[model samples]
Target: MRTRPTTATAAAAALTATAALLLTGCGGSDSEDSGKDKIAGADTGASASASPSLSSSDDGIERPEVSLPEGDNLIFAPETTGDAKADAVLKDNAEYLRSIDEAIGKQNPKSEAVAFYSKDSAYLGSVEWISGFVKDGVTVTGTVRYFDRKVSFSKDGSAGLVYCADESKGYTKDVKTGKVNVTEASKDSYVLYNDRLRKNDKGVWQTTKSTSDRGSEVCQP
Candidate 1:
């Protein structure tokens, strides 16, 4: 599910979804401008389906202490559920996926990650996939660590998370062929994200339906 096509009519409309299992190919450039950059409506595909088994016991649950991102190479894996309102709705679901990587690393034309999503959030279809890499100039710089967060709540309010992602030193830079690419790591680069949250009426825990598997051996690293 690695679909890359910043244009040419989004590579001919992603070749008719080529059997549908997309997501994974963020950061794009090289636009021939048929205009359609899509990288979000959330469906990071290719799921061989095998991720429901996490329960190593966090029963005491109180985690929430991971804020690193100022370069230690990003890493977040403190999961919880001692039930402080479901751990503050999973710490606002990891700060709404770190506010969409801080609005695609500050390209911010209007991304506060849409205040934690839920307008039918697949993270708000990544706001036109981060504005087509901020309109082809480039602005997604590195680090997207997250790891092993499993969360699961339901009294019918519904909630779910299945995180793990390394993004191997994440990258994106073609501001005119300075070309960087990077996001490779392998064993399928340890990735998995299966969210579905719900709790909005101002209560917030937003995110609504998301999917991604992209090479998971239970998210290796």
Candidate 2:
């Protein structure tokens, strides 16, 4: 039997890449889906601390607008940050994962999973890989590497997390031999997940999911 242990290491490294992974979104048609998703809603006016107003989403990444729908979803998000939320979320999540990297070894899967999420690894789990997306009047298409991630804002506006697969490169795991083999010829798709939060009650966002990338894919909803 092969005792190659890189799978665990790779998995751990993947946990760190949660921020980079959660950007994937399932494909949708122009008729069914619009350029922007309507904000669910929030009562942040209650706080008097509002996010700065932005002009446009011409920077490449789409700026999700937060507006009070007819009810709750919209109230929570009057405006969306210009990639600020996604960037900050990724950065904070990376920091949190680094802090616990050595702490959460292979021995702890469930605990490590939670640790990863608490650190804000966005949508690092429950992903399906397909390819491409539409953003900001621009259809910046991409070949779905390995999977897709879902993004959402928390109810309190203090937290937001993602659940996506992290298919960084191409490789395979010979479980019978316990070997995580790699090769340039290996381009078949496999899904992984990365969940990250913007803010947590504990003060810092972290990973939320990513048990395994064995089976998951991007879904259209």
lDDT of all the models against the reference? 0.49, 0.30
| lDDT, model 2 | 0.30
Instruction: TM-score for candidate 1, please give it.
Output: 0.29
lDDT per residue, candidate 2, 170-220, as tens digits? Answer: 233332343444433222233334332334442334443324433333311
Backbone clash pairs for candidate 1 read 22-45, 186-189
Question: Candidate 2: deviation at residue 3, Å?
Answer: 15
Give each model's clash number. 2, 53
- After the best TM-score superposition of candidate 1, give how far the Cα of residue 162 lies from its true spot, in angstroms: 1.5
Candidate 1 positional error at 43, Å: 27
